[model samples]
Target: MNSLKTNYNIVIVLFVSIFSFQTNAQSAAVDQLHQLYIQTINTGDPGNLNTLYTDNVSIRNSDGSLLTGLNNVKKQYQATFDNGKYDITLKTIEEQDLNEDYMFVSGSFVFTKIDEPEAVQRGTFVNILKNIDGEWKIYKSYRYPEITNIKSIVDGLYKSFAQGDIPSVLEAMDEEIIWNEAEGNAYADGNPYIGPEAVLKGVFERVGAEHEYFKLDDIELHEMSNNQVLATLRYDAKVKETGKTYNAQVAHLWTIRDGKVSAFQQYVDTKKLNDAMSK
Candidate 1:
């Protein structure tokens, strides 16, 4: 009976050893795959890259466009290489093994134009890898720029404001954001609010104090060049002192950089605002 118990313990120990070995091997393979990808991008060579992805794999680009199939993915990469050479770097933020056959990996990447290293683009990516014939291959992939979606970022800010998420609204602004109100508007007294704190105290707070209910209407975001977004909207507000409502046409030109609003210039019908505030 003691001999049988000893054998059983040995079997358990062997099982644990085998499991640990498998886990370590999987981790090493995944790391190697990422390294290969970086090397391929830097060299502009598709060497063994076809083996990195599944035949039916799909990749989502920063602009929300999808590239389906391995051949198309390869062509896309070649096309990108044709346009310009880039030095790409990837860092894995998180990884999870979903099962024996699948894993999820997410990370951030920086792409620097080889000829112009100063021109760098930062983004995050997600990859779903499937194990086929003991080899892990990307089954699905997604990548998005950190600062490219100017219109979406502005839209999100407005949505946050509508939801009364003041903190989120302020968080979207850059540290040195140059905020300006329409020249003759009351808020212009504190034009060029230097930072988030200044804008919060000088503009947002004052607006909140002077209005019974303030809201934006008819917001149309226009994607402009030079990292700028032009928002054409109407300010719908009721002044607390005069109990009068004003729907003033307004235009906001927002300059964005590094995923933050760097500058804001407001153009509004100042006469409407002045009339609304007059008792």
Candidate 2:
């Protein structure tokens, strides 16, 4: 009886020891992943970022745009660099473990205009990291603009428009769309268009008619309330009528309902668009 009791105690001790070691190992892995993410953003190196991301990582932009794969991530950073003037700083606020292999990290980012010290913008980012092959990599990333700025959503919308994926583009809107443009002095009155058909006819059709190719240069998305999103975007487009090129800035207000865009309103620099088309 005494020998059996001793053996049982030994087994219990071994089990506890194993459990503790595993918990510690997992914690260390999560810390390493957090560090890797911070380092990648600070270095602005795609390779470094890739080291902490899966090949098919999913990036969720503040404006609800989803970018998958390392190539897409690289392209996004390249676009920012090409624009010629931006700086980014990231801070991790919290982390939660979903499982042994999955964790979520939330943080804030401050973007500064390289040319204008006073012009600084801040946002939030949430990233999900997974452990694969004994390494922690970012499996997903989501960014949300601070309440005061909404450029990310605008960027995603314009990119969708340019890609001719109006359905994916419209999915980001609220139900009662509020459309406005800077150049045309045009306000799409009365909640604008709801559903895909109205979006296809009113916005996509009009823009597609004049521009042969449209590309978004930058986008920023800001979270205003639990359900409200604001976005600002800059785009370069080629006019089919005259083969002219124009860069325009646009803004949008979006309200989300039931995990779908319920309403959307857009504002664009019409003068810039018109001038490019005329030229």
Find the 10 residues in a row with the least total lDDT in model 2.
181-190
Q: Return the lDDT, model 2, position 3.
A: 100
**TM accuracy, model 1:** 0.55
Q: Quantify all predictions' global Cα lDDT against the true fold.
A: 0.90, 0.70
The reply for model 2, stretches above 4 Å from the true place, is 1-24, 85-87, 149-279
> In each prediction, how many residue pairs overlap at the backbone (N, C-alpha, C within less than 3 A)?
0, 21
**How far off is residue 134 in model 2, in Å?**
0.4
Candidate 1's error at 79, in angstroms?
A: 1.2
Model 1 alpha-carbon drift over 4 Å, by segment: 1-5, 147-152, 155-279
- Alpha-carbon deviation at 75 in model 2, angstroms: 1.7
What tens digits encode model 1's per-residue C-alpha lDDT throughout 132-247? 99899999999877875789989999999999899999988877899999899999999879999999999999999999999999999999999999999999999999999999
Q: What would the TM-scores of all predictions be?
A: 0.55, 0.50
Local lDDT at 66 for model 1: 89
**Candidate 2 TM-score, true structure as reference:** 0.50
Give the distance in Å from residue 122's predicted Cα in candidate 1 to where it truly belongs: 1.8
